[model samples]
Target: MVANRTRRLSVRNISVVILVLVVIYALVGFVGLPWWLERVLPERLEKHMGWQAEVGDIHVNPFVMSVEVLDLDAEDSDGEPVVAFDRFYTNLGVWRLVTGVVGLQNIELEEPYIRLDLLEDYSVNFARDWQANNPPAEDAPADDSDSAEPMRLQFDRFRVAGGELLFRDFSQEAQEDFRVTPLDLALNDLATWPREDSESNYYLLAAVGSQTIEWEGDLSIAPIYSRGFIKLGGVTHTTLQHFLKPYLPYQLRDGRVTLSTRYELQSADELFLTTSDGQLDIENLGLGLAGHDDELLTADRIRVGDISFGLNSRNVSTGTLDTDGVNLSLYRDADGAINLLEPFRNEADEEPADDSSDTDMPFRWTVAGVELGNSSVNWRDEQPRTGADLSLTDLSISVDELSDQLEEPVNYKADATLGGGGRVVINGQATPAPFTLEAGIAGSDIVLAQFGAYINEAANLDVRDGSLSVDGNLDLDQQQDPLTGTFSGAGEIASLDLRLGDSDERLIGWQTLRLEPIEYNVAPARLEIGTVTLAGPTVNVVRGGDGLH
Candidate 1:
């Protein structure tokens, strides 16, 4: 009878203990814990993160192992809001709580507005916050030490929807507003630990100005390595032109531009930028002086494709770049200035371009090849009375091994169809500093009338029935103390007739003229002649005018 009573009392006692424990758990998860945390979390977060943080209506759902915070607001010291969001939801794993560590499985945010501003002298508030949050690189010794370990944050996934971002640059005199609406970002399976099977991936989409940007790829957020493909759809050339009006020397009136890039990166003192394929396209682009309306140059189409490059500790390299459909006009104005290249000359007092190497940067680089195709160039000279037009069609350029700190020399080759039915071919090789070139110019027949402007510029003469040919080699070295160069060639001309610039009638004629092995050097301005031969030369004398002898 006593044994039976003991068993009954023990069962009743166990049931009472279980009921009390269940009540306590319910109160802590549903009301007590969330209320206490919401009251203190704002101040604690603000103090620890060095920013003002406010939280409203936090709810902890123990049954679902989840927490949701509604209406979170944060601001920086300058009273500018860092971020404002309608809702932030985080999912938790019960196993993590048992391990006494705060770990999140998924974090989702709704409708956040984030702003970034650039300040003067390259100082920015975003940079301060980034440095504050990131681990000190200086503290990590260069030597590999087991004792030192970087603190890593762990999270499974992160997502943001219906976001808006704004950026402003106040560093320069020209201030432009940049914004992206309906910005969305997502990442999944992110972790501090490196795992081969890690399916960490991300995607982003935003519209800034007229450009729509889309990015998708794999990423590792901690210890930072990422690979992504980006597509920038058709940016408006007019918008870019106005935005860049301040610093540019010429105005861009119209164009349609698109770009795409595939890249991989690794974060280190030495950056590794690995690109698989990249391309940029522009069509119907007009180039002109900044304030002038008349277009100085225009291109029907331009394409740069198949670009691949990488930079790392030892070297930098480019796979190949193909440039096509480049058409433009070059002109000399009445002031004897070539408009194509005149605007780029910088004054001596202005700051020079930056060529300083980062002491740790890789010194060697190679461009595997570059090709220019379907290029047509037109040059016109409008110097007072001399009106001349020159055209080069069927023009193509090729370069190979263009490199520094490499074993092979850089090679360049050009083939072009010249005006007056002439063809020119040139080939050269160099260490990229000092170079040598071999060239040839030949045609069965060339008209001197088409080269009238060159004659007037060189010898102040007008000519008819002119024919010219040259087979030459040249060597140049600008790296020398005073700059030295040499050119040697054999030249020939046939059926040439010339007259003084003031008179149109021919005064001199030659059936054939030849110069063999003529050489010249520029450091001391020396000329050496091997042989000069003239054939069937004739001169006509005018009675009342200046005549040829």
Candidate 2:
């Protein structure tokens, strides 16, 4: 009986002590702490941060080790909002308070509005604060070097909800005025201490002009690392033209461009972001040049597979790039200038130095391969009345090892059907510099009827009927200025007939014509023909007095 009575007293006394402690903590947190902070923090923040600040109400519950700051607002000197929040919340560990220190386990900024801007002179409103917080080595004190004793702040989880951000830049007044609004983001499981289970993850969504952008990914703080994906969707077509017009030298009359990209990032060093993997999709892109209604370039779809790039050090690599339903028109304008070359004429090519001592190379790109499907092209000249206009349809090309470095030969194989049911095959390997190439080109059943109109317009002549068959193999070298190349081919034109442009009367006819074993040299501008054969050739000489010959 005595032992049981003593046990009961001890339990009661322990419960009583806990109850008293809870009450005291409640008094301090719910009443005393809130009141004190509301009075002191608001006054001190404005003076210390050099900004206008306000705090509506503060709430603390030491029992739960939580704090809530409500209706906080801050503005810059220009009366623009630096930050405003409906509520700011934080979670603290109760046991940690015993050490007379505050450690935050989590923090949340709810319905926050943050505004950032850059002026014409490339100055930002928060430049000073940002520089102070992230100082360069030369500007920082020697003692606070990279190996210094690290500051300890336990912020594990951070979250933002119903947040909005506006970013603007006034750099290029005419074209560089940019803005994004109604930004929303969320971040969770950010830990300073090492965690083996998982990693920090985040998601951000925003609107830029008429486009919507979204990103979701993982991130870490110490030894900073990140791995995530970003997506951009719902971009309007006309918005692209308006934005691109100022950057290009040519006028863009009209175009329809839709872009959607999903990118994956895995940084080897955590600094170069582009050296990763991703996909790019562009749809219904059409570009037309000035002074004409003809399209310069058109494509139904362009997609890039796994991609990696690091322009900071000029290292880039990409997987297969596929383009579908593409149509390109290469034309010479009335001024005897090719439309394709005009764009590059205005672009200043970076001149290379003579040696490594004078130059820092900036290009080291590698592409695994490229594939084109169901494409077509038209090559024409407008300067000549009857210049050749050739069309290739159902075109496909497979290219491999296209790199800026000559370490590997670029290999390509292509096949295309002529407009009138003829087909051609081309296969080649070439080096970019100290140029060398070995190629084979073969075509069959190239009906001359396809060129009837071209000959009529260009040479004031007509093609009655003809077909061509060609087989060729060539080797070319541009390594030396003299430019050496050799080709062995035999081509035959059969059952050919010709007439004057405006008349259907036949002037000449041939049963067969062939050329074989041809060679060419650029330095001397000469053509070597091993043999030429003609059979059953006939011509009607219309004498001055002749009527219909």
Give the lowest summed-lDDT range of ten residues in model 1: 435-444
Tens digit per residue, CA lDDT, model 1, 337-446:
87766667555468888977767665766666888777778888888467889888778888875677543567778878876567777787766445334333334445
Per-residue lDDT over 1-549 for candidate 2, one digit per residue giving the tens place of the 0 to 100 score: 999999999999999999999899889989999999887776665555455788899988786788999998887766777878999999886665575435677798888877777666778757744554454777665674667645544565777777777766555545343346566777776755445787878888887665777878777666566666676664654555455666765554434333333434443464445536566677776777767788877888887867766645667777788899889889886688888777667555767555554337667877888999899999887766656677899999999868777846888999999977589999988887888888898988898977775567667678878789889887888878778887777788888888777677787879998888766655566778788999989786675555544
For all candidates in order, the CA lDDT equals: 0.75, 0.74
RMSD (Å) per prediction = 6.7, 6.6
For each candidate in turn, the TM-score is 0.70, 0.72
Q: Which candidate has the highest TM-score of all?
A: 2
Candidate 1 pairs with clashing backbones: none
